[model samples]
Target: MISGLDDVIAAETMLSDVDGLNGRLVIAGHSLDDLAGRTSYEAMLALLLGEFLQADTAAITRNLAAARREVHAYVEGIDAAILALSPIEALRAMIARLPDGEDRDTAYRLLAAPAVFTPALLRMQQGLPVIAPSETLGHAADMLAMLLGTVPAEEQAKALDTYLVTVSDHGLNASTFAARVVASTRAGLTSAILAALSALKGPLHGGAPGPVLDMLDSVGTPERAEAVLAAELARGERLMGFGHRIYRVRDPRADALKAALQQLAKAGAVPAGRLALAEAVEGAALVLLRQKKPDRALETNVEFYTALLLEALGLPREAFTCVFAAGRVGGWIGHAREQIDHGRLIRPQSKYIGPLAA
Candidate 1:
């Protein structure tokens, strides 16, 4: 029996690798650290989709932006009555309306869906009208610009770019796995993305980062962090950002976001010493956690710094997961394409434990 299939090699891949034990990640031949502050989200997307998408960079960028514009129109047309729904629910509705297909145009559809869906979700949460996308700017810049109705600051743009690139792809996470399974059935690209988003909406997947802010609010200050954390631990609570299912050491993306947060803090874009305070809390909590658990390795993951960085960027907590979806749309599309190209119906058998009928 494979008994839990511990470390079972599922597929041969060229997408990305997650070395959990070593706390490293490589995407398409570049280490995450090398690419983090170095490449724009558009550049990183080109790298991930290059082997499969042969379109010219300018053409792809234009197509993607156009797609975003199209989806923005669709989102604006959604009834105001529906605006009262949860952000994720509203996003799901918008995505559900996307056209179905796998032709060259499908790439544009995938690109547009996230751009429209995420902003619409954010606006709905704020009880504001969703803004339509403008074709005049780059995709990442346009997203921030549309959401705020003004051109983003240079550092803000850079931070958003880093956030998007860092999260654009990860090898076969739960939502990506769901996407792959759907794509493996030769489903339409939109269907695959919808499935992926459904998975991502779940608490175990993309719903974590918002809670990190709550944790910070509860702790309130560096001096109070240890006492709050100690009490929370005593109550058998898990710290919001302290553990990941994959990385035993530390999430590579956390460091990247931490660096971005530090830069933003230095530029006086955020409160002074907030990052340092978070670090102190995290360090104290980790040390105390290790002493308590003794056997399990529960290190900080991407959500920790994700919350801090987005907070510094002045985004509300409710918008955190929507922001996540904005970046991950590319990876979802790429993986869906790869799964479709590979052509397998992802059917797996489960061990039967219930009694058989007579």
Candidate 2:
């Protein structure tokens, strides 16, 4: 048996492919390079959902916008106790209120839940009123508007959209696999999405992006980057954003987000010093990693630029993973449907190494 199911192929999908050796990703028929900055998140959702269902970009966009408005009501139930928990926890609690089903309607609402709940939870935690959703705006734009109580610039909205589209799907990742496992069991789309969210909450997955910001904060400036990273390496602490379980070279998503960050910087939306320092730290970390490890490809991954972009988008670091969920939920729902349509129950055998019975 393959430990941790490494290199195991469980299901066939037309969704997304991760090519680690070559550092490439394809979502549906589009290359990540083509999709990330060019395609809207709604359109990306349309592309993924089209694999298993019939929906156009405009219809999917309109439906998701309406669903966001519908899910906004669930935010009213986020009481003081819920606000006391972390943003992701609060988001999860609110999502549990959504009705569960495998229908297209349920998929839309599940896809929309995190976008609505995350902003409201954060606003309420900061003693601010929850901004209602806008039917006129697209998913990424409306999320930023609700979070900041102001319409974001076109560039900022596009950056968030790029992020959503970039991460919409990536083969059978931990969360996606978890989502598909529940889906294969005939669990509804909402149940599958909740399983994905639970998997994403683990630090090894979506929980990682927050700490990328923390690492930057600790480094403080570009000049101190080498010394700081060297110390971390010497202490045998893993540099948070610099390595990947796949991708022998740099993560392609990192380049996608770096381009977004650059575009945001060009628009004067991101602080130049912050961008410069992150670049410096990234350079330093790459050099140090090559010198120290020599055998491993500990290049910068998605988390590095993700931290900078999300912070520039005015997301509190604590809410990073929630936003990640807001993007990935579409893929989760689509994968759930795909499993329901064409897959069997996911059961793998274990090579028993425990005590033998007579």
Best by TM-score: 2
Expressed as tens digits, the lDDT of each residue in 1-358 for candidate 1 is: 6854457665556778999989999987889999987887777778878656676567678778877877777865677655776777777777788788877677677766776677666766677766777777777777777677678788887888889989988888878888888888877888988898888988889999999888888888898888999899999998998877788888999999989887777778878777767887888889888988888888888999999998887677776777788888778878888878875787777888899999
Off by over 4 Å in 1: 1-6, 124-129
**Candidate 2 Cα outliers beyond 4 Å, as residue runs:** 51-53
Give every collision pair in model 2: none
User: lDDT (CA) for every model shown?
Assistant: 0.81, 0.90
lDDT of 2 by residue, 111-204 (tens): 8888888888888889998899998998999999999999889999999999998889988999999999999999788888889999999999
Model 1 lDDT vs. the true structure? 0.81
Q: Looking at model 2, how many pairs of residues clash?
A: 0
Q: Candidate 2, overall lDDT?
A: 0.90
Among all windows of 10 consecutive residues in model 1, the one with the lowest summed lDDT is 3-12
- Candidate 2's displacement at residue 263, Å, is 0.4
